[model samples]
Target: MPSVNRLLHPSEAAKRLGVSAKALRLYEQRGLVEPGRTEAGWRAYGQEEMDRAAEIVALRALGLSLAQVKRVLEGDSQGLEPTLAAHQAALEAQLRQLARTVEKVRGLRSDLMQGRAPTVDELMNLQAPLREVRVAFELPWPWGGELFELRDIRSLNYIIGPLGSGKTRLAHSLAEALPNAAMLALERLEDDGVTAAKSRMDSDPILKSRVDEAISWLVEDGANSSDALVVLLAGLEADGPDALVVDMIEQGLDHATQEALIAWLRRRGANARPLFMLTRSCAILDLSAVGPDETIILCPANHSPPMQVAPYPGAPGYEAVATCLASPEVRARTAGVVAWRPSSGRLQSLTP
Candidate 1:
């Protein structure tokens, strides 16, 4: 009798899961997913591994980061109740904000119909009534150097730094400091490699159609080029003379996407000014991906100048921000609304 055929090889497994061999290795490195290994030390994948791999691939395909995937998969599926509860609470807050926003828009529409020009002050007053409902907390501005206000610049700013550098924390503080602003958590986006790979899969007409639909939704959902910039600017204008904080988890964005993002930002900067808090591995702003802008000096928390390089290598400005915000003294000194708190996960406001 013929010997039973073994399950798929690593390469075939990757293909079946719609991921690259490298990604599989990375997943293994993170201990999030594992595959069988042969006595010869070669990687082997069985049906169970394939199923897990498919789940990993699908979660990633839905724009979850590897870290998030780990949390979802290995993180107390039985105890996911707490996370689910947190998410539900957050969603309810967003719903309240959206309801208020709709009312404001309706009032503005009625004013327009009555032939009244909506002044900035009038619009702001309309929004201010809802502000009283939010709790006030303080996050001292990060990097206490000198803030050089650049006026008439575009209404969306993107700041990038490596992980654990404090960008996310700083962004949360900034969002709290700026009234009428909304903070969005950035999801992963497809880079050139993934886009090309997906395009290649178009050889299968059915798969291609599905891929196209996914791409369309990704952009429309505010993860793509035009929509991302557009929504950023629109949010700023609607929020009024304030900043918007985007908590970006930069995962699959490649060089080309970075360049396109920079160019778009520059064009917008020419008109209105906004603040962006981007956290990532490298500074794509200075790269050939887009035209470079002069680095404006922001005041550091200790009155120190913004260093040309990260004071701590690999960490960057985020560290400075984190150090300041995490201080109990600084937290006490902060005035105005503090929307997010990293430690307790308590958010004071319900604005979307």
Candidate 2:
């Protein structure tokens, strides 16, 4: 039996809690949990700290923000009700899916007992939810018309390349090729765009609420609200499109805003709508944060066909993707430097 007052090291405590040591460190940083320090300065989690940490983890798993968790931990129950209701609804949805799976299995078993054999395809269709959505289309201009096949389109897909790499054209082509997809162009930041975005948000109360919640969460994560961001996010959170392709998703945002925005998007989970974001900011395209439900598409500088890059250090195109991305500060510094493509006879900058 474990000692009631025994203290465990950070790694041991994290293992016991089914979380990572980094998560515990985050909890500590947020003042959500306070662990003791050993004589050698190593962190130690006692029973009290472990209980508190577990509560924080549970609250986070229920979709509550760190700020919301803090408020609930402070004995304020107002925010808890809505979060609990959301969690309950999610669980209910999962239960319904599970029920359908059980029924399918029972039916299959009954048929087997009756000497009726099911086909392999029928058995495979039972796990339809786990299947990936694949898309194939012909590549657009700047490259010879080549076939582009994208398999297992994930929740978050990043399209990245240097200027003049035809990334924008690729994004547009994807939006055109994919079913129920639309591209949110940079013109959305033009004059009167915010008004149009506001109108759309006003037309859909649920979408507006979701956007508001996301904005609040981003704000808590150190993001500053802007008309540009609001316009972009309204489209992203809107319900009509099955997928969205965004050009320069980190445009007009500072480093903190970019980081917070990406973090917020990542937290939306694997079931969220597929999003194709064109970004060159390291903050927006953090390779380390790429999950199984996220994919990176890199358009090589040499005009080779765009290929999906695995989120590992040594993967082909992985280094290219990393090279294309810059720290938000670096991106800001070089934002005005345009690539010069000289026309025939005389050196002239290419214009849209």
Candidate 3:
């Protein structure tokens, strides 16, 4: 008898589900969904498995924890109340914003009827709220003063380059140029500094609550708890600064942690503020998993001006960007390894 076939592979399932293959692995780890093993021992998602995974993904979209999702799946409705309330509040806020936008549109139409035309900027802003948000500056030290201007910045952006490529300077320049933006570098390593940071969190219940929730989610998603994770989450959950530029986002994270962290960062909702993260870890900057709302900026090794790199192959700077990325395991192996910088400020080192 012929065997019945036609189950999707993890990558195909992930593509259809609008999530990363890593996410499906995490879901399986959390006992959320189980895919079938093929005759060759490969995981295959049949219809039943896909349906279950889809339910878990939907619950996650509603901001439900994996544990909470399991509870709901097991016929326990208790965890739904708070999540639904928060979802309702977010929807209501969006409704209010839409009402204001409608009022603006009506006024614009009235002006048109009265023979008054709206400016291009006004029309663009009306059509796309974020269109007016722009970043413009000159390329910094490593390159000559080349003008750079970016409009409609996405929520998650990556700045990647080889060592001594001056990605750090570019990140700092971005933070300085963006209005109401802040930079969180990897400089808080001293014992005293860690203690002080924890003390601040312990003192502020509200801040502590936000940080704790973020930590719990990351931990549940297979990330290891560490001082580095805590510091990053504190900045991410803090209630100030419209945008953030993070230096070396995967600095102290392990392989699993880096995978989980990037997955979590990608799940930030549509209204999430812009984030410009500098990273070379392949896990953190997985070209395959990049979505429409993410952008990649590559700093060339030849000290040329930084330019945006498309996720696809053959695009300008795509190979350079790809060559710069290393798996988290490889990166960890090379941790604390540095190349000597020469008089020209260019360091000689192969990609990690």
Candidate 4:
């Protein structure tokens, strides 16, 4: 237990609470927990604040959205059932795995009793590995049919690169190659997609309900309502494909909405399906907030094969990844900027 009078800086508090400082800021933005201000006016968390944050973290771990957490903290249990079910499913999966391990151990003991020695491979097979979601396919256009193979996919993957890089093609190949994966493209932000999304929502009451609930949650966390948000959430319902690839997830969202949407996506916890998002917004991929379950894939400017990048300053391609990400404000300002392929040239030119 921490001392009652002890005060922790935001980073220290986040470390102690096993979360990111960005998460703490989001909690504050949602008015879920209020920390104190030191003489320098920096946010400081006391013991009480730590305890409150711990509660919020536990609720979030159970797959409750921020709005759901707010409601539960306010003494209403309105929306806990679905989240609780999801949490239970995760726990039951673990339980089944444990049972299998127990059976393996029992078989090992039986073999010992029969004076039989276990083989090396048999001994190694006692423990189960995490799910291996892999995709392998020939590279799409721009490259000369290079083989691309990706394995050990994480829950949250970001695909990033500069404007003219083949990142978009790579994302497309991934969407086409991955089993049961679908790409929610930039069309989701277009007027036709918005109208079709609304029509789908109108026809599917369950999808509409989920979207409404998610929108309500985002709205409470400083997001404004727009067709962009509606269509995005509609495409991202829990009942969608096994994996989703999003192209420019922050395409039409404002700063506040982008921030809130990212926070919400992170809070989805175990209920979140694997998402491969091609992002250029800093808010959508905060390097400091990248967690164990997140992976960053970067496409190089020179058209070298896309590679996984470690989320640290000194890693290879880290600078390029950082350069690809622009603040939401910057992204909004440059929304109308377009690059062109000049006439008659095998070699591309950025020289104007």
Clashes found in each candidate (C-alpha, N, C closer than 3 A): 18, 0, 0, 0
lDDT of 1 by residue, 1-352 (tens): 1122576777777656655565576678768777888988888987777777778776554444455567779763443453356456656766787787888889889999999978897677664422232223433345443442323223444444333344555566656655666675543123443444444554556554544433333332223544333333333333244445665423234333433343334433222345454533233233212222323222344434333322222445645433332222232244233455455333434434
lDDT tens digits, residue span 1-352, model 4: 4555789998999988888898899899889999999999989999999999999988877767777888999999986777778678877877887788889889999999999988887887775343447889987767768888887687788999998789889998999998898999998887899999999999999999999988887887678999999999999984758889999999889988988887778765533578899999998899988887789999888888888999989999999999999998999899869877567653445446
Off by over 4 Å in 3: 1-5, 130-132, 339-352
- TM-score to native of every candidate shown: 0.30, 0.81, 0.87, 0.83
lDDT of candidate 3 over 12-31, digit per residue (tens): 88888888897798789888
Q: What is the C-alpha local distance difference test score of each model? A: 0.47, 0.84, 0.83, 0.85
Number of the top candidate by TM-score? 3
Better-scoring candidate (lDDT), 1 or 2:
2
List the pairs of residues colliding in candidate 4: none
What value of lDDT does candidate 1 attain over all alpha carbons?
0.47
**Structure candidate 3, residue pairs in collision:** none
RMSD, model 2, all Cα superposed? 5.3
Best by lDDT: 4
